[model samples]
Target: MFDVQHLSYQAGRKPLLRDVSLQARPGELLAIVGANGAGKSTLLRLLSGDVAPSDGLVQFDGQPLASIPAAMLARRRAVLTQQHTLSLAFRVQELVLMGRYPYFRGQPSAHDYAVVADALATVGLSALAERSYPTLSGGEQQRAQLARVLAQVWEAELGFLLLDEPLTGLDLNHQHHTLDVARALVQRGFGVVAVLHDLNLAAQYADQVLVLRQGAVVASGVPAAVLTAAHIEHAFDIAVELLPHPSLDCPLIVPRPRAGVGAAFSL
Candidate 1:
């Protein structure tokens, strides 16, 4: 599990994140929701040890994150960013196999191949194993990236996954499918801290929600506890109805127009 305490960061004279703190419980799905420039990505980078906090502490399983070695950290936590671009053209299978580099040091074994195969299967990419990554569709590319991250933490007893805008650039079906894969990963005892732009998607999949505005947490708790009509309205500057999802037993958000606005009555 990941625990952040009194986290704060600054970019030159400007503050990016201030007084941010939260804990991701083991096997729970925690979604971080905020508008642009709200420091969500900064938070993720700090947690993943890609960037150190200017002021505060990040702990992984009781030890400070900085205390963990880089190689060992990769074995414990996996991260997938929003902008995953591959400059070098590689086959889908090859890109995924790269995840085992920490263990195999560029020379894969039979066990590494087994792990990569399982990772591909987890993301439903086995059929496209031999496909070239650059020629694949955007959705397929995203799934390939998912497969890489899956292989990174594959059966390594990982504690958490740090994902930023993981549902970007996908159609509705793939969005749902990708989130389902994330959910299944969390169910298998991986804590997840995902920064998501889509509040409804967060509401549907996240066990807990953290709403940040202007680089601070406005609310943090279970989805129902944090995702209220007024909270959404305040955090997002839009009016929405928080309804009960018929099957998921979670809150669903339905956007409604503000007063004096109509579809046919435009100024």
Candidate 2:
């Protein structure tokens, strides 16, 4: 399991996260939600060891994150950020192969290539493996990046996948596909934590939800418990109606029209 205690991050005189504590275990998906500047991404960074917490502890399994070597850490965890800018004209296959760097160094073995191919197939980009990454559409590029991350820890038994707004450029179909992919990983005993903006998607797929307001955890529990109308209003400052999903045993959120607002034609 991945555990964090009293996690806090500060930049200069400003604090981004304060006294945050959470745990993500294998076979479950933890969804982190918050409004802009709520430090959702910052928390992911802290957990991924990309940035050190000003005060707190992060541990994977029984080892402190800071004590693990970089190469060893790469083997156990994979992170997909919100945005990636690639200027090179590398093919999609080559980009995904980069994930195997820790294992292959410079010379890739047959098993490494096999892993790359499997990763590409997992993201539904097997046909486009020869295409240039820079030439793909925004959503396609996002999937390529995801494939890279998946290939990183494909062989690990206990691994963590941390994604920050991974659905940014994906279309509706691909968005569901991506979340389904994450969910599938959990079934294989990998802990998946994602920063998601879409509450409904989180509600549908996540086993646990962590709501953040101004960098502090406002609530954490199953979607039905943490995604209450009251908590939504408190964290987002917007009115919403929560109802049970018709086909799924989860909450479905719908925006409530303001009292004075009318239809566009009525106005």
Candidate 3:
């Protein structure tokens, strides 16, 4: 449902992303993983059309991202970035209700209210709907932001969902549950591309993985193919031991021994 071809992003003289090409399909969850400064966030921004690519095109359903009108794009695509801060003294329900802005001009209709309520309930925020946004903790706020996106783009069919580092600040249970929500969306035929810091979570949740190193795609494929121990060491410069999970039906990654602690190995 979403395609990026030869995508590149330049900031001044430095290129943040270089020739990053990939595709996201309906009923699939794609995770982009890389170390800090590897341009994961930049790639997400480019894919979401929040920032235009300095080179090539980001296409959604065969249409150039730049050609889409703002209102039309918002009605189809939804983005939840890492930086979410609001100083306004609005209630949580009121905040989540903002997601319906794309559907309603300014005033929300009954359908919009129903969407907002559903979004709040989806994120387990129904009880906190009347609370102030500022009073919630960081994790709660993050979930609230997701609820807003859910409410905003619920009417959107055949669209892209870009979530940049959505797991940050979330507890373990919330993190897993957040991915559960995303996976449910994919099951319902939404194309999802997320920037994930936790490789374990990515391996467990993503249908495919895209590994970025130094602004370029170093590897991209199924988790079992793209998340090998060598690739993890090469991309992140950290040694990890790859082994099958004891009970779970997936590969698990664990930190390898330190330099002086065990035998050395080459990548």
Q: Which structure among the candidates has the greatest lDDT? A: 2
Question: TM-score of every model?
Answer: 0.94, 0.96, 0.95
lDDT of 1 by residue, 1-267 (tens): 788999999989899999998999878999999878888999999999988898999999999999999899888778988887788989999999988878876579999889889989877889999999998888888888888888888876755778888887788988888888888878888888999988888889999899998889989999888999888888888889877788887888898968765856786
TM-score, candidate number 1: 0.94
Model 3 CA deviation exceeding 4 Å by range: 260-267
Best by TM-score: 2
For model 1, the run of ten residues with the poorest summed lDDT: 258-267
Task: Give all candidates' CA lDDT scores.
Answer: 0.87, 0.93, 0.89
* RMSD to the hidden true structure, all candidates: 2.0, 2.0, 3.6
lDDT of 3 by residue, 165-266 (tens): 998789999999999999999888887899999999999999999999989998999999999999999899989998998877668999876666444553
Clashing pairs in 3: 99-152
lDDT: the better of candidates 1 and 2? 2
Lowest-lDDT window of 10 residues in candidate 2?
258-267
In candidate 1, position 14 carries an lDDT of 91
